[model samples]
Target: MGKYDPLGGYLRRLKTDSVDLGFAEIERILGAMLPKSAQRPQWWANQIDPQGRHVQTRAWREAGYDAFPEAGAERVRFVRRQV
Candidate 1:
């Protein structure tokens, strides 16, 4: 499990094609404000740790979801993978 496992667990409990949540909602799950880097696209990319494991991306992928930021919006949209 990674530090962001809470986000993954929340995503797993959702049953929908997509969900749009405000930064506040995400912070609620994270129990803290998002880092400034989180607003950057690179932060969402699959980053590898020194142990050769994906950090943030592992959470969503494990929950069968992917998150994308809406252009000019303050919310993030998480989409479920098509089976």
Candidate 2:
């Protein structure tokens, strides 16, 4: 593994939080959060469900506990679980 891995030590340095935001919104936040010279971050795998929840596969939408759009995106905020 490398320093840039999701579970790597570098990730701990990210300015993350647990807040609600739409997919598009989270995308913008991630763009701002990452270092300009590093590889782009990607959404955690557990949050996505290719054959299950459609919202997880697509953009964010209001749906009960799923109300937290940031939970499904790669952004630091709203991260339910880490790699």
Candidate 3:
């Protein structure tokens, strides 16, 4: 993995109901700026990457969480699942 796979690390460390983080905060965790696509709604869909080698949503799902980006908002929320 990259030096800063925020989703993986964040999901691993989640121990609360949810986490609300702005793009800047996420970027900090990622150690890099997000791509322009990351700002689009489609990018938040739980889909596979073009290469199909991995599921884009696997990390959060495996961590028993779901992620949602609020419409017209500047932050994304990662909510824990009850299981």
Candidate models: Cα lDDT each: 0.77, 0.33, 0.71
| C-alpha RMSD of candidate 1 | 2.6
Regions more than 4 Å wrong, model 1 = 46-54
Model 1 agreement with the true structure over 30-72: per-residue lDDT tens digits:
7878777777766665444567454777777778887787655
Candidate order, lDDT descending: 1, 3, 2
How far residue 7's Cα lies from its native spot in candidate 1, in Å, is: 0.7
Regarding lDDT, does 2 or 3 come out ahead?
A: 3
Model 3, TM vs. native: 0.74
Q: Which numbered prediction scores highest in TM-score against the true structure? A: 1
Quote model 2's TM-score.
0.23
* Model 2 spans > 4 angstroms off: 1-17, 31-44, 47-83
lDDT of 1: 0.77
Better of 1 and 3 by TM-score: 1
- Residue 53 CA error for candidate 3 (Å)? 7.6
Model 2: per-residue Cα lDDT over 1-83, one tens digit each: 32223222222343553344443444353443433321223332234465653333132211111222233243333342432
Model 1 — which ten-residue stretch has the worst lDDT? 45-54
Give the worst 10-residue stretch by lDDT in candidate 3.
Answer: 47-56
Ranking by TM-score: 1, 3, 2
Q: Candidate 2's error at 9, in angstroms?
A: 12
TM-score for candidate 1, residues paired by index: 0.79
Model 3, residue 72: distance off in Å is 2.5
Q: Model 3, 56: alpha-carbon shift in Å?
A: 4.7
The segments of candidate 3 whose C-alpha lies over 4 angstroms from its true place after superposition are 47-56
